[model samples]
Target chain A: MEYVIHLAILICIYLILAQAFNLNFGIGYQFNLAHVASYSIGAYTTALLSTELEQGFIVCIIASTLLSALFAVLLGGIATRLKADYFAIGTLAFSFVVSALLINWKSLTRGVLGITGIPRPIIFGRELNENLDFLILIFAFVLLVQVFLYFIFRSPYARSLKAQAEFEHAAMSLAKNAGLVRNLSFLIASGLAGLAGSFFAYYINYIDPSSFSLTEMIFVLTIIVVGKPGSFWGVIAGTVFLVLLPEPLRFIDIPPSILGHMRQLLYALILFSVVWFNKANLFPVQRGV
Target chain B: MSLDILPQLLINSLIAGSIYALASSGLALTYGLLKILNFAHGHLMMVGVYMFFMFNDWFGYEVIGSAIGCIAVIAFIAYLSLKIFVLPFTRYSYVLSFVTTLALSTIFEAWISMQFGVNVKSLTTGFQVHSIEFMGIFITPIQIIIILSSIALLGCLAFFIHYTPYGRRLRAFSQNEYAAQGIGVSKTNTSYVVFIVGALLAAYAGVMVGYETNMQPTMGNAYTIKAFAAMVLGGLGNVWGTVAGSYLLGLVENLSIGLDFWGYSIPAGYKDAFAFMIILFVLLLRPQGLFNSKSRAA
Candidate 1:
């Protein structure tokens, strides 16, 4: 029961992540590879505030979410100015910068030893220490974020984003500031990703640099691509499908060491096949940049 | 701080830059022609280095011969990757190609780890023991060989691209694919040659890295990023320009190792970050890259 609840909580966290990714890459048509960096900023922020500052849950999550948003603003302000392909490269550099900071800033991040004993959230003056309690909290976050995402998708802003994605000139002709919309969307999605990261740090009771690497970005990208981005329900299904795909392999009698790599191998192969088969609909020549 | 280390650092920079230059030219050129990022280029080098290791240990092949064989294997993989995964995606599927290459990179890393059990292996051959000293500074024969090899390879490539008929056709195709095709260049045959040469060059860079530093699965990623920095620093598609960029990158990267600031010394581990910072700075200040006046933004 605990294992199943653990899996559910993880899925909840990932649903928020995949949805946030969807809002940016899917709706905004911006390929920000630094999503993981913002996510890590949230994690590190929450971890540091809670452990170093001895802050409460509300204070930690809010502060981290805001900090992550601020970083998104700084990163997006510059990154979104570039053309599409260069935007990816710029964000990738940002991701590496964040990663370098996390790994090298021994003074702040503790340099890969990671923060430990991160307390579970205390809600309504009661500590939600148990796995079940955390699941409820995670589920709440997932629901709240999902609702927010739904509104964003339905809002007038989303129409502009849609127009911008389909054709920037068309969006411009309609008096939509495509750059402003993109930056704003990038900000919101990064903040949400931060929220997801906070929940992840809280639930796992641990935070490490390894959890937020380029591999994590690849995993999210796979979910968005496989789920057929631009559809909320499709992304949700993708998150669930991919999160659970490796579980059955765990039950098989494989050695513990090789099993970990085997799962990644499977993911790589699946990602390759997905792109190979879905090439035309995915990245058409007309959408070159 | 002693001033003696500066000269050594300069030499180290030279070595590091050439390493990056050798590694990145193929990736930059492939991206130039096909618009595919070739994320697996570094991993292909890692695999090639391992092949060199296997050939040396198990097959008892000579060092130069094994290096040659490494090129052949990677060329095949490059061609296969293009044909099997990359070419199927119609023209201008940049995102698809990028993601596919990224996926292939992951596969290669994981596959290498699974096969080799994540153990680091030294790849220096019997012939790598000799060194030459100048002005009380010692340099290995292998380092000189690596440096000279990069220069020769880049020179040969530039010559081929400019002087050879097929190479000119390939460049013409790169500049304007439809125009080149209209002019009767065999686009298909040229693409094969491009893939083969690009793969071979990247593989050669990998073997050189493995020769100096021991082989490890994770090493490919760091070098790949460095190569990327070098590539972008020099210019995206210009061969000689990238070579110059590589040297500059090597100097900065090596100089950062023992860097002192305000009485606080920076750790060597932070060296790679300097390159990434350069990349971010370049991407923002001039996305066309330092040496590139023409925008390769697309």
Candidate 2:
């Protein structure tokens, strides 16, 4: 039961991550590989504030979201002027810079030792320490984020974001500010990622650079792509499918060391095969409804 | 800094920069010709390093012999893989190819790690620690080889791209793939040759790097970023620009360490931050890079 609840919490965290990434990559058609960097900023912010100042969970979450959104604005301002591929590369460079700062700022981040013993959330005179209680909190957050995303996805602003993604020149001719839409989408996506990161740090009670690597970014990307971006339900289903798929592999008769590796291989193979099978429809940006 | 220490660091930086140039030049070629970012380009280097290690271990080949063997083997494998797997997806969207390459990168890294444990393997010929004296300056032989080989390779590449028929065809293709295809150039064959050559260059760099530092599965990650930075700095799809960008990066990093006049030094880990800052500044102020005349392409 505890293990199931733990998995549930992780699924919720990833759902938030995948959906947030989907907002930009899927809706805005901007491939921001540095999304994880925003997530890391959130995680690190919450971790620092909670550990150093003994701030409550709500304050840390809000601060993380705000800080991450500010960073997104700056990064987006610089990157939105470039093309999609350049934006991806820029974000990747940003991720590297952030990761380096996290690792080398030993005075602040404690370098590689990583922060631990983070206090969990206390709500309404009740301490949520048990796995089931944590699951409920995480699930509620995920639901709230998803609902907000759903409304945004249906908004006129989102329609323009989709239009810009589909054809920037055409959208501009149609009187849409493609750059502004791209920047706004990026900001919202980054803010949500920060929120997710805070929840992740709180749940794990620890945070480190390794948890927000290019590999992790790629995994979230895979989920978004596999789930068929731009569709909210697609992202939710993708999170559940991808997160659950690897679980069954644990039962297979394989060496403990190789088991983890085998799952990675499975992900690679699945990603390749899916991209290949969906090649015709996958690459072209879908028009906003 | 002491004069001796300054010279040593300069030589070291030059050597490292040369290797970075070698690997990144190959990446630039593919990007130039295909307009596709080959994310597996680093894995091609890894395969090269692994082949060199395997040849030396299994066949008792020396470093030079193994380097040649590694280049040949890597080129063939890359050619075959491109022919079999990537060619079929040529008409597909660019993102598909990017994702496929990324997936291939993961598969290759995981496979290598599974085959050889994650421990870093030493490939030194017992001469890595030895230094040669020239004009009262001490330089390692490996460092000398790295610099010399880079110059030679660049010269050869310049010759190939300028003087050879295939090179001319490559240039034409890169200028306009559709036009080249309209003129009866086989896009498939050109892509295969370009990929193979790129892999060969990357493999050669990998062997040299393995000799300089220990080889590990994850080494490719750092090199990938550095190569991308070099590619962007030099102007993507420009070979000469890549070489220039590499030296610029090497000098900046080396000179940063050299400028610690008050006995205060920047930590080595901050080197990447320094590089990132430079890249960000360049991208913001001059997105076209130093040599790039046109606007930035992805």
Candidate 3:
């Protein structure tokens, strides 16, 4: 039961990330790879606040979300001016900067030693000590985000995003504020990623630079791609399936040493084959003049 | 603070720039031709370095022999990767092609770690480290080899891209793929040649970098970002500009470490961050690239 709950919480965290990422890459066609960086910011913020300042759950979550959103605004400001491929490269550079700070700002982040013994969230004058309690809290937040995203995807704003993605000039000629829509979606997506990061810090009770590296980013990217980008129901299903897919590896009689890499290898192969088979069908080809 | 550190820093910068040039030139070519960024480009470099180590260090092959064997092996891998991982998506969106390379990168890193263990391994060059001192400057023999080889290779590339019929065909294709195809420039043949050449350059860079630093699975990640920054700074898809941008990056990165500004100097650990800052600043200030006059083709 505890193991099951752990998996559930992991799913909840990834769902928020994938759903948010879907809004950017899937709908807006903005390949903002700094998402994991924003998530790292949220996690690190919560970790520092709770460990150093003795902040409560609400304060940390709110701070992390807002800070990540602010980061998104800045990132979007710099990267949105570029085209798709350059935008991806630019955001990737920003992600590297964030990772550098995390690892090199030894005085604040304690460097690679990592911040440990992070206190779990204190809720309403009570400490949520139970694993089940944390799972419930996380699940509630996930549900809220999913519903919120569902509405956003259905709105005219989403249509504008898709329009801009398909044809920026056409969307602009149609009087859609393409820039504004891109920034708004970017802000919301990164903010939600931050929220997920906060939950990750609380649940794991330890936060490290290793957890937020590019490898983790690839995992989330795999979820959206496999689920079929730009589809709400698809990402949700992708999240559940991918999160649970590797669970069966535990029962195999492989050495623990190789098992971890085996999982990564498995995911890589899956991602490759899926993209290979569905390359033609995955995303609509960007319309050119 | 003194003139003393200038010579060493300049030499260091040159060495670093050469590696960056080698890495990014291939990236620029592939992007120029296919408009796809192979995220696994650096990982292929890593594989080349390992192959060199296996032949030179473990099997006791001569230095030149090992490099040749490594290049041949990497060429085969490059051909396989182009066919299996990169080519299928050429007709589709470049974004999907990018994702495929990303997946390929993950596969390479994981497979390497499982095989070699995660420990950093050093390349034994079969000789003691020898640095030649001239006019208050010290240079290593291996460093000299790296710089010379990079120049030779890049010179050959420039000659190929400018002086040969094949080169004209390549340039024509990058300019207008449909027009090139209309003139009977086979897409498959062009992609295979460009892809293999790019891989060869990256493999040579991998061997040089392995000589310069300890080998590890994740080493490719930093190089990929650096190469991207170089490619962008030089102007996306501009091969000559990439070389200049790389040399500039190497100088700036070295200067950040070697010189103190206002009693403060950037730490060596933030060298990669400096590259990122350069990308951000360049993208914001001059989207056309720092040196390039023409804006990139949208």
Candidate No. with top TM-score: 3
Interface RMSD of each: 1.7, 2.1, 1.1
Model 1 lDDT at residue B172: 87
Q: Which consecutive 10 residues in model 2 chain B have the weakest lDDT in total?
A: B84-93
Model 2, residue B278: displacement in angstroms?
Answer: 2.8
Clashing residue pairs for model 1: none
lDDT of candidate 2 over A1-289, digit per residue (tens)? 7778888888999999999999898888787878999999999999999999989878999999999999999998888988855666677788889999999999999888888988888888687898788888889889899999999999999899988888788889999998899999989999999999999899999988888877787788789878997889988899999999889777777778777667777788888888878878886844444
Clashing pairs in 2: A86-B298
Measured against the true two-chain complex, the DockQ scores of the candidates, in the order shown, are 0.67, 0.61, 0.80
Question: Which window of 10 residues has the lowest lDDT sum in candidate 3 chain A?
Answer: A120-129
Sorted on TM-score, best first, the list reads: 3, 1, 2
Look at candidate 2 and tell me the lDDT of residue A280: 82
Native RMSD of candidate 3 (Å): 1.4
TM-score of 2: 0.95
Of candidates 3 and 1, the better by TM-score: 3
Which candidate has the highest lDDT of all?
Answer: 3
Please, what are the lDDT tens digits per residue for candidate 3 over residues A1-289? 9999999999999999999999999888787889999999999999999999998888999999999999999998988878878888889999999999999999999989889989978777778889999888899999999999999999999999999988999999999998898889999999999999999999998888999888888888899989999999999999999999999999989888788788888888888888988988787887887
DockQ sort, best first: 3, 1, 2
Pick by DockQ: 2 or 3, better one: 3
Off by over 4 Å in 3: B296-298
